[model samples]
Target: MKNISWIGIYPALLTPFTENDEIDYPLFQINLDAQIEAGVDGIIIGGSLGEASTITAEEKREFLKYCVKTLEGKKTPVIINVAEQSTKVAIAMALEAEELGADGIMLLPPLKYKADDDEVVTYFKAVAAATKLPILIYNNPVDYGIRVTLAMFEELLPYANVQAVKESTRDLANITNMLNKFGDRFKILGGVDTISLESLMLGSHGLVAGLVDAFPRETVAMYKLVKAKRYDEAVAIYRWFMPLLELDIHPKLVQYIKLAATAEGIGSEHVRAPRLPLKGAERERVLKIINDAIANRVALPDYKNL
Candidate 1:
C-alpha cells in the first residue's frame, strides 16, 4: 500500500467480471493501472459501485490480495468497504483486509438492518478494536436507512482510528454542524458526485468520487482546480460533467459507470450476474450522453487519450 493522504480523489472502484461469473483480472488490472496513471490518490475496493452485494466474500479476499500485490511499488493506497450486516462478519472482514495489506477500510452501518444509535456505535467500536487500520465511516444516511447521527459520532470519538467519514448525507448544513461541533475531528470526504464541488467549497478535504472510476482525469482536474482556488475553471468542467456524474445516483450505477469507464478505456462494462447489462432505449440514452461528452469533449491536454 502507498502513503494514503485520505484527502483527495479516492474513487470507489467498479469491479469487472467475466461472462463465466468470475473476476476478470486482466480487465481489473487495466482499471487499476488507469487510476494510477491518472494520478488518483487512492482506490476503494468492494464499494457499492463495485457491485459488492453481488460479489462473494471469497472474491473480495482475492481482489484485496491482488491489489496489495499490484500496488506494492506505487504510492496509491487501497481501501476496501466492509458492508456486512452482521458485526461478527464485519469484524472478520475488517481483520482480513488489514491482513491482506489494505491501507484502510470504508465501513457502512450494518446493511439491510436498521441499527439504532447505540447498536451502530457498538458495532463501530467492535470493528475498530479488531483492526489497527484507519476506518472511514460510510455515512450515507439517505441511501442506507441508518444515520450516523452526531450523538453516535460522539460515542465513536474515543476510537482514534475512526476519525474520517465519507459524508453522503447530502445536507450541507450538516457539514457546517460537524465542523463546528468537532472541527477537524473527522476528515470528511464528499461521497455524492453532483454535490462534489459544493462539498469542497464547504471545507471537505477531498472527494470519494464515483464518476471518476471512468472519468478519472476530469475528476482529478476538478479537484485540483478547486484546491488551487480556481473556482471558475473547476465549475466549467463540473457543468459539462454534471450530467454523467448524476448517473452515479441511478439504480444501474454499476453498469452505467462501467460503460463510461470502457468508453474512456479504463474498465469493462461487464457487471456481475444479479445485475444485467443495460439494453435497448436505456442503453442508447446512456451511450448518447457518454458519447456526446466524448464528442464535444473538453480539450484537456493530459486527458485527450482518455
Candidate 2:
C-alpha cells in the first residue's frame, strides 16, 4: 500500500477556474505550489471546497493528473475525493484515482440521497474492498446528511485500507468519542476550521482545513504551535484567524474562499454556474473580514523551524 501519513494539515483545496469557466491550469498550479510551500502534510482534491458538484468527471481526472504530475516526488501526497451518487461510479472513480497515481481517497456518502446507516456502511465497505489505496472517510453528517456514527464505523473496522476520517460532524465530542472507542484504529482529522484548535487540543491527528487554501502559512504555524505545546501562541493566531475561518462554513464558501485566495494573490473568484461570484453587500462584507484579518495578520513564530 502507498503510505500517506494522515497527520498534520491537509487542505481541501479549491479548484481555480478561468474567466471562461474552464479549469485554469496556471492558477491552479500557483495555488498548489502555495500549499506545498506552506508545508501541508497532504492535499485533497475534488472536495466540496473544490466545488466537486460543478466539476465534471473528465475535469476531475485531468486535475488529478495535473496535481499528480506537479507533486511528483515532492513527498506531498495528493488525495482525491469520491462523492458519487452511485456505488458503481464511486468504485470506478476510486479505482481510477489509484491508477492515475492518487496517494489516497477521501470517500463521502452517496451524494443527493441520504442513505440509512446500513446502506451507508455498505457503500463504504464496497469502495474499501475495491481499492488498495488508503481511505480517509469524509464524515460530515452536518452537510452530507448521512452521519457515519461510531456504530457505522464499527462496521468498517475490517477494511485495512479505510485508514482515517475527516471528522466534520461539527460535534467536538465525536473526536474524543473516536479516540475512546477506536483508539488509533482510525486517524481522526478535524474537518472544520473554526473548531480546529479545539479538535487538535482534544487529540485529533490533524486537520483537513478549508481556509488554509489562502492562509496556508498561518494554518501550518498554528498546527505546529499546538503540537509543540505552545498554547498561548497558537491561540493568538487562531483568534486572529477566526473571522476569516468563518468563511468556510457559509453556503457561498467557494466564492468566499476563492475571493480570499485571490486577495492573497493565489487564485481567482470565478466559480461554476449556480454559484455565482459574491456580489454587492455580500462581497463587501466578506472582503472586510479578509482585509481585517490581513491587516491584523499575526507575525508567526518560527513554527517551521520549531
Candidate 3:
C-alpha cells in the first residue's frame, strides 16, 4: 500500500456550451454541481471528453480557475488535463493548473512526432520538474501515436511528481503486465468505459469514465460496489450500462455524447467545428437508445424536452 490512493469514480466531464458554441459557464457550474450531488470522487477537466483541442488556451485557463473556485470547500478533487503538442506548452499549462489550485494534473505524451524512450522520459521529466502537485500520465496511443512502454515508465517513475497513469491503450495484456510490475508505484486509472470492470478486477485504482458524464449515479454505484469487494454486483451494473458505454467507442463519440446529454437536458449537443451534431438515422438511433434506457428506469439524470 503505497501513497497512491486514487480510487473510485472520476467523471471525464464534458465542456458545456451554449447554442452559439460559446462555453456556458453557468451550465458548466450546473453540471459540476450535479456531479457532486451524484457523489463522484473527483472530476477531470479538459480531457478528451472536454473537447480540449477545440477549446482555446485562454478558455482552458478560465475553466480551471472556475473549477478551483467552485470546488474549493468541497471534498471532491479536480484533476486538470495539461496535454499539449509541445513539452514546453505542457509544462506551462501544468504550472498554471497548479497555480489555479488543481489537486492534480493529467498529461498526454507529446503529439507532434513519435519520440524514443529517452525523449519520452525527458518530456515527462520536464513536466514533472514544473509542478509540485501530483501528475497523472495519460497514455492514449490511438490519438497521440505514441505508446509509453513499461520500460519508459520505469525510467520516468524516478520523478516524484509522476504519481498516476491513465492507461487508455486497448491492449489488456499490457495493462495486466503493468499491474503486475508497477501497481505499487503508480495509481493506474482505466480510461476505457467498456473495460472498466475488468480494469478494476485487474488492479486498476479506478476509472476516469467518459460515460459517467451521462450516468454519474450508476457509475458511482458501480465504483462503490467494486471497492467494497462486491464484484458480482458491480458486474450486474456494468452489464446494464454496457449499451451506453458502447456508444462511446463510435467515431461520432463527441456528437453522440452531446446528443445524449441534450436529450437528457444536461447540456446541448453543440460540438465545435470539424465535429457536428448527430443527425439522420444516427441521431434517431442514439435518441431511441437513451430514451429506452430512461423508460426502463436505468438511473438516468433528469431528462427534459423529450
Task: Give TM-scores for every candidate, taking all chains together and pairing residue i with residue i.
Answer: 0.95, 0.99, 0.92
1-306, model 1: which lDDT tens digit per residue?
223568888999888888787899999888877778778888899999989988888989999999989998778888999999899999999988988899999999998889888899999999998889899999998898888988888888988888689999999887888888889888889999989999999989899999998888888888888888778888888988988998998988889998998898877778777788889999999999999888877745343222
Candidate 2 structure, TM-score to reference: 0.99
- The clash count of every prediction, one per candidate, is 0, 0, 0
lDDT digits (tens) for residues 50-130 of candidate 3: 998799988988888888888877788888888777888888888888777888888888877888778888999998987
On residues 1-306, what C-alpha lDDT tens digit does candidate 2 reach at each position?
899889999999999999898999999889888888888999999998899999999999999999999889889999999989999999999999999999999999999998899999999999999999999999987888888999999999999999999999999999999999999999999999999999999999999999999999999999999999999999999999999999999988899999999999999999999999999998999999999989988999988888
lDDT accuracy of residue 41 in candidate 2: 98
Top-scoring candidate (lDDT): 2
In model 2, the clashing pairs are none
- Among residues 3 or more apart in sequence or in different chains, the pairs in candidate 1 whose N, CA or C atoms overlap within 3 Å are none
**lDDT per model vs. reference:** 0.87, 0.94, 0.80
Point out where model 3 deviates above 4 Å: 1-4, 298-306
Q: Whole-model lDDT, candidate 2? A: 0.94
Ranking by TM-score: 2, 1, 3
